[model samples]
Target: MSQIERGWDAIAQLDFDAALAIASRLLNNPHLDIRHQAYRMMGMANYRKRSVQQAIPYFEHAVQLVDNYKDRFSLCMCYALLGDMDRADRLFQNIDSLWGLPVECYVSIVMCYTEPKHFQRAVDLLEKIKLSYTLLGITDQTFLAIRGQLAFHYALDAVHYVLNMVSASFDTAKWIKSFAEEMDEEGKKSLALVSDQVCHTKGPFTINQPNSRLQYPLLCKIEDVSLFEEERILGIRVLYGKLHVG
Candidate 1:
């Protein structure tokens, strides 16, 4: 077998050191394609080895040689993994379309948002994924579970933002109600409890209410949100189960 094929074989076998060695040798090849492949192999090997920082330059080199979807996507993943959300977001935006990408690719993209608590973006992407699955007449239980997890996080984050007074105009109650509508029975119940708590504390006061007496109730709501810890734990357990199965 050629060295490139051998390098790929080594990567498949999880022998990252051997793959890196082979790829390193090919880096000086005369052909651009060969050099690009070498860089990609090295990047893949390092990434699989959990050497994410080491992987970036190789992926960057590959992209420099051939600025295609696959290389750019791989580089974007590296940036996301490194917690460089701005760079990753930029790369993701540059991609023309996610059509025809695998479900795992979509999941990875969602995770780029989800991991950094960018829950709204994660939820939006999940909605798009669901639409794509519907258009293609595809139904998968694993995807459904993943959707639920993402949705749960989105709801939780919305509540968190409201409780923290991060955004003045955020309609937490309205968002919770809308999210609850699409949830399963258990999910709906959980969100219902959260909604009730929010409403009870929120009372008749708007966030912009200048009344000091009303401010006390809003302050109390911050502590009230913690009362749903059991629900939060349950949701987390469900997420863990779904992720484990997937």
Candidate 2:
């Protein structure tokens, strides 16, 4: 087998030191792909070993070799692991793809921060991702998977935060209304029951605490979801009053 293949085999065998040793040789390979792969392999090996700072230069070199979304995504995760969330988010936003591994990469970063101190940050990050998917018309299965992951990792509190945000957001509320309207009476009833359960389940955490103070632009963007919902409800109320007068 080629040295690269052998190196990957070593990695698969959990011999990170062996893999890194092989990666060192491949880093100077004449072939560009081999060189890039060497850097990435070193990064992954170090990342698996929790040597985040050591992993970063390898990922950074990989990105320097090929600055694609996937490369940037790898670097983003590395930054997230290093607790440089702002850098990670900036890199993620630069990646314009709406689906595929990019979404998975972003979710991986959020999931990495599932400790109690960082859990709210993860939830907030998930919320922003949900907003993106909502705007992009992503699948219900995707949404369900994300919600399930939140519940699995952080329990009901995280799920309830998402649910409450959905309850308040016009786009998500419209999704619920449209979905219910498409169903039979029994299905509608079932949805209502579930919605009631979700909406009523209060999260243990506050929305905007000191540590979770959102930055501008994105903060405004997130608030726009609620504001849009409020405006839509007000419009409905005005129309109802006019109809009653007529």
Candidate 3:
């Protein structure tokens, strides 16, 4: 493991600020690999702290050093953190319209577009993207790395719920009823677990530290989305979940 990765053990142990400090210095370490690894570690760290500003530079520098879709897509993440949907959208648009725009980045874009509430325009855009209404932004990759499409779908539904909450602030029952109506009989049965499914992530990575817990956003997985829910819900919570996992 590199220095940054080694320090990550300490950071994951709960030394947040200390981890940030080490990441800051090691990000520029003489070793190129260490530098990039440091940046990635810092990006994940900032993400955990919800400090989008701190993650930006690390992700930006990471973009400069790496050429693969993961790293480039990584930069779009900073845009999402900064709530700059325009830039994040544009970057994904420019990147060959590839299928793997990094699920992480896509989740962020959804968060920005669906924030506060869901507008018809947002719904239209989502439907367009989902049904291939235009297919203008499609791209092909060697293989599908669609790590958590379900997570994204569930997120959208949750956003619609939030929209209802915003539109009808005092009627929780009414809101749940309307939300439930949108669901099919089967999906309604799992509304309680919708969040549990969407919130939990399944992966093969492991690390030991005091703060490491299932609640870690890094552990949050994007499960299969329901036919009834919107992706916006997944976007908002997934972004938050990624932070905890980190």
Candidate 4:
């Protein structure tokens, strides 16, 4: 195998010493791809070793060499871990500046929401995006197709985690009810489907349903959203299930 390949292999094997040794030599490689890989390997190795402070510089340099989406994401994650929320937020916002959001970046952003400190902001952004779609009444096939690809489970999973797992100061229940109340039938279907998927129940799967099978916001009453008891119960049961899952 090539030296860079070997370095990556070592990184995968959790041999940071060997990976660093190979990466150091390849830092000056004429090929940008090799340099990017080498730095990424080193960064990942350090990150795995819990040396996040050390990993940041490698990721930073890797992004400099090749504005690769994953590399920028790694840099953003590193900054987030380092308690530099502002820097992390800037990098995330800048993601579409060059290329549109990569599929994996959606996962990264959702994972960020798992952090307690960033949870509220992440939920706010998610709610805003979902609301924008509702406001636009984006039932267009092309838009739905693109949105499905970009979001899929990440956005819903983030919301699920916050609702079920987080102990936040913010009124999460109120927000969830508000979001559901604001969505269209299709949007409600998506939310309901995600809710069911996360809760591991087969009671209602509306994402693939016909117009006749649609339910607005699925589990809550629109006229009286104050009755979110069922959702709260489901969230509790799902949280318990999630906690015990391997």
| Top lDDT hit | 1
Give the per-residue lDDT digits (tens) of candidate 2, residues 1-246: 988888877766668799899999888888999999899888866765657678888888998997766556667766765556677767766764533443445455554443346567666666667766777789655665555444434433344455543433335445446444544564455445445445444444433334233211100001111212111111111000001110
Model 2 ranges off by over 4 Å: 97-101, 113-145, 148-159, 163-246
Better of 3 and 4 by TM-score: 4
Error in Å for residue 63 of model 2: 1.4
Ranking by TM-score: 1, 2, 4, 3
Scored by Cα lDDT, where does model 1 land?
A: 0.58
Q: lDDT tens string, model 1, 32-122?
A: 9999999988987787675778888998999899877776777777676566767877787676364345544566666545342566666
Q: Candidate 1: where is the Cα deviation over 4 Å? A: 97-103, 115-117, 135-137, 152-246
Q: RMSD for each model, in Å, please?
A: 12.7, 16.8, 15.1, 15.8
Q: How well is each residue in 27-51 modelled by candidate 4, as lDDT tens digits?
A: 8889989988888877866765657
Each model's lDDT: 0.58, 0.55, 0.46, 0.52
Clashes of 1: 0
Model 3: lDDT of residue 8? 73
- Model 4 residue runs over 4 Å out of place are 114-117, 124-246
For candidate 3, the 10 contiguous residues with the lowest summed lDDT are: 140-149
On residues 1-246, what C-alpha lDDT tens digit does candidate 3 reach at each position? 755655576455545576677777886678888787777667656655666666767777776876556555555655654556577667766663665553433434553442423334344334334424224454321001121222223343333323321222243344335444545554455444443432232322222334222121112333222211111112333322233221
